[model samples]
Target: MNALARPFSVAAEARLSSADLPKPETLIRIEDLTKVYDPKEGPVLDGISLAIGKGDIHGIIGRSGAGKSTLVRCLNGLVAPTSGRVLVSGREISSLSGAPLRAARRDISMIFQHFSLLSSRTAAGNVALPLEVAGVEKNEIRRRIPELLELVGLSAKVDAYPSELSGGQKQRIGIARALALNPQVLLSDEATSALDPETTEQILALLKDINRRLGLTIVLITHEMDVVRQIASHVTVLEHGKLVESGPTFDVLAFPKSQVARSFLSSIVAHDLPRQVSERLRPSPAPGSSPVLRIVFAGQAAHEPVLAALVEQFRIRPNILHGRIDYIDDKPLGVLTLVAAGGTPTLPGVLAYLSSLGLHGEIVGHVL
Candidate 1:
């Protein structure tokens, strides 16, 4: 490791949008983006267009065939787009090559889920490899390696080889190496799917902290909605290689307007009753039993005790049949299934009150 390997910081130049006013949420632009692997299937991307904002923790979500990997590769020039243009810092990335291409690649960093660290190299050595490739001096590599390890909380194990490190440790090394150039944008390709849930949370915390502290625009590609809810401020849903939905994380979760978006939201929303549950444990409806309602809470609404307020205001007895809470981006995000004891007529009043507090309530079934 050499002195020339010290943290290399590069600022991304902003490109003014056609909006005329400062381009908001348009740091990187993809217009009519298309990729074709085979002539028979046609283009995989299918003319997708998107704008990623600066300092945005953007998420691209979809199942296996969504052309996610191909899209990210196109952004970095690793995969060529058959048609359309990718604008990085407002310039056409598709037009860059040679030294300019290398320079452009440096502005963006990508982390793979596989933790692609060198098996023969120690953690520090693995991180220092990038700097070495750029002809950084030995003394600087040593300084930067320690700094990188410290950034990822692996300073204590800097000398440990990849084989000796745990999966989490290996990923920490991968993250450190990705940040070697201090890129303005970080690309995470399912970086947490390979880890256990607890380890996933740890990595998520680190990623969120880095995004906030460095103001780095992060593009996370994953199939898991949990991963998006954990750290992304904004989300983009891709299905069949097309854009299905894109907006703030909470908004999409609250009112999913697309089938793809709804599918992604089911784990956190009051989805349609399962067939087994619908058929089993259902008792005959009795007079004065109560009406059941499912309420979804998130963002500011989760902070308010709306359900408690409803009980007090409507004088309606409430019984909780099912409840769940999910934390998204370190904020309270959850779903609740409950049976409220009251007449059918009073249900409207209680629901309206809950809605006034920025919460959503859906009646699932009547309770006796």
Candidate 2:
């Protein structure tokens, strides 16, 4: 589906209060942050609150016009919120002004999807621009430029112009530029959206490397679930302007509660049911029809022999429909869709057994 075609609502379902979020000194905290583009129409970001821990790769995902773009801009004072606070390194930046705001911004840096580098400048020149603007001496700029380029794996391409570099190399330059000030926080505003799948994976890997090596707090805003799955340690799901869900990446992907979260994970874990199965599916089981069930396994439960147990304990054989096993934070998270020969009659026992094993099973549809 086209992201712009999706529906949006300014009215948030349930607001997360500051008290409910993690309060760590080494984190960027957004408290009751709301941004109103047009006061009469309502806020584009509605009282969104979250905490990004130090050295964490936090992803914010939502469809287009979901306020992800505005949220990232707000982090560095490019777009100030109409109400609430954006605390960076324990200092409220929403109200900072002049030199204070400029100093605060030095601790925060951003990279773009478009690889916003000057075509006239070489990769080294672009990375040196930030340090130059800060009035760092030319000698120091020369020393730091090579180090930053090497960090992003673009040392050989330091003298290449933007026009001469590949998509991934240009993005590497962008990453190098964002790190010129040695910012504690790096905001990636859809940094991988324009690249091919392979290149995207490379950029994601580089970002992960930067986070681990430099202990940078990376906040990424994207609509791509695969991007989040590959790198983000934690994730926040947005709808319109409201935060629908926020939690550790594996936990959220394994068992998403909100409509937005379920939709994203569904694309990755559940996908579309087979045409043959879907064509015959109905809300209620018909005579001689089987019931389609979705089973979610995470943590220690993911290692269980669920299908074997189902056959042995309930005396029911499940025909596997669709399934996938994903690794998040090095832990196995699995999802399986199957059809049991018997319908609702055996569901209770099946659910009981799954519960005993700390797994989740839901009847999604019925098919012949």
| Maximum-TM-score candidate | 2
Mind giving the per-residue lDDT tens digits that candidate 2 earns over 144-249?
9999998888899888999999999999999999999999999999999999999999999999988988989999999999899998988999998999999888
Q: How far does residue 322 in candidate 2 sit from its true spot (Å)?
A: 1.7
Instruction: Give the Cα lDDT of each candidate.
Output: 0.80, 0.86
TM-score of each: 0.81, 0.89
Q: Distance from true position, residue 259, model 1, in Å?
A: 3.1
32-98, model 1: which lDDT tens digit per residue?
9988899899778988998899988998999998998888888888888989999888767887888
Q: What is the Cα-based TM-score of model 1?
A: 0.81
In candidate 1, how many clashes are counted?
Answer: 9
Best by lDDT: 2
